[model samples]
Target: MKYQARLSLDVLFKFIFKITGLLVLLLLGGILTMLVYNSFSFFLDVKPLDFITGLAWNPTGSSPTFGMLPLILSTTLVTIGAMLLAIPIGIGTATFISEYASPGVKNILKPAIEILAAIPSVVIGFLGIVVLSPGLANLSNLPNGLNALNGAILLAVMALPTIITVAEDAIHAVPKSYKEASYAVGGTKWQTVYKVSIPAAAPGIIAAVMLGVGRAIGETMTVLMATGNASMMPTGFFDSVKTMTATIAIEMGEVPYQTTHYYALYAIATVLFFMTLLANLLGEFFINRFRKYHAA
Candidate 1:
């Protein structure tokens, strides 16, 4: 009787999990469908070039411009900036927690780092506006303190915990046997870490950083709050900028649904969706390749 009941519970759990997976897929499809439906009218009027190449974004002006170069440039610049900031710090922090931290220290610090992950995006944005934006704008070279640089820095901070936590987990996942074998061969601790452990963990570290890229690309509130929303292509790091996500958040409220500007936002959204999708795809690809290589 006990065995039969256990089997029934197992079957029930499997059925529930299958249903849950379907629901998640259905939700995603609904979103894609809605975006496509909303974007049809706008696509009919503007050539892809208008959004891709045209300059200026004053959609309400008599000579309205929907060119998205400025927004795209901002997103690219900010993401790159954040990546530059995140990579070294995140990897270093991960290495410390996983490789060097004492148990007691890690117990405290891990939770603290994870806390950054839980903080609301709005709160982060508020910090950028109240603190970072003003401070950055005060730089002698920066035309506006609130520029791409500050927004990127904030985004990097937001992305760090994700990168650190995941990479730390990856480093932790390394087998003790591997370290033992390295020492058996007279490998120094740093040599074991840099060569055997890190190479083994490289795929996972890459996966973690890729996730950060997606997060950076999709971030809206922080970018909106910190980046001075100028719609022009950038000349340097300190230039005022606008990102696709920032543009959507700032303008979606006032723009009518059927106008060219409305569609422009959707188009920008589509571009963002593709950017995130590409990041995920690349991550998956590398992860699979690494898995196969590791297996071999």
Candidate 2:
């Protein structure tokens, strides 16, 4: 009876796992169907080449054109800026925590990062507007307080905890023996970390970066509140900017019921959804490759 019960449980577990996977795939499929259904008019009427290559964004005007270039450029620029600002600091913080920090230090630092993650984006936005924007204006030559640099700075702060935590977890997962072996071969502590731990933990670092990217890409409240909310493409770090997520968030409520502009909004959303999907896929692929390289 015990043997049969164990076998039945195992069978049930396998069945549930398969069903769960199918459900996830179906959920994704359903979302795609909805987006496409709503977006059919836009895709059919809007010239793909024009939509992609053109730069105007008069979404609510009389002769509204839906060229996505400005929004796409702004979104990409902010995401890149945030990543550039966050990744190095995050990686360094992770390395220090995993390899050098004492127990007390680690305990303090870890909680600090966790708390950062828990803070609402709106609060961050408010801080940016009230505190950071003034500071940035005093620091820079921009006329208004809001700009890409300010948004990127706040986003980097927002991204820090996830990057640091995930990266630390990755580094910790590297076998201690790898470090020991490096030391046995006359390697210094820093050398061992740079050579063995970082290489071995490369996948996790990439995963962390990708996770941070996703957060930055999907972020709305902070970007909307902090980015000066200009719709034109950005000219420099100090320029007011708009992003795809912000555009959708701001316009979703006010758009015509079923106009081409309406479909265009859905289409832009679809682009973001796919971009995020691609980022995850690429991140997973690189992570697996890193795993195979170091694990084997």
lDDT tens per residue, model 2, 20-95: 9999999999999998787777989898778877798887777887889989888888888999999999999999
Candidate 2, clashing residue pairs?
Answer: none
Candidate lDDT scores, in order, read 0.87, 0.91
- For candidate 1, what is the lDDT? 0.87
lDDT, residue 271, candidate 2 = 85
TM-scores of the candidates are 0.94, 0.96
TM-score for candidate 2, residues paired by index: 0.96
Clash totals in order:
2, 0
lDDT for 5 (candidate 2): 100
Predicted structure 2: lDDT:
0.91
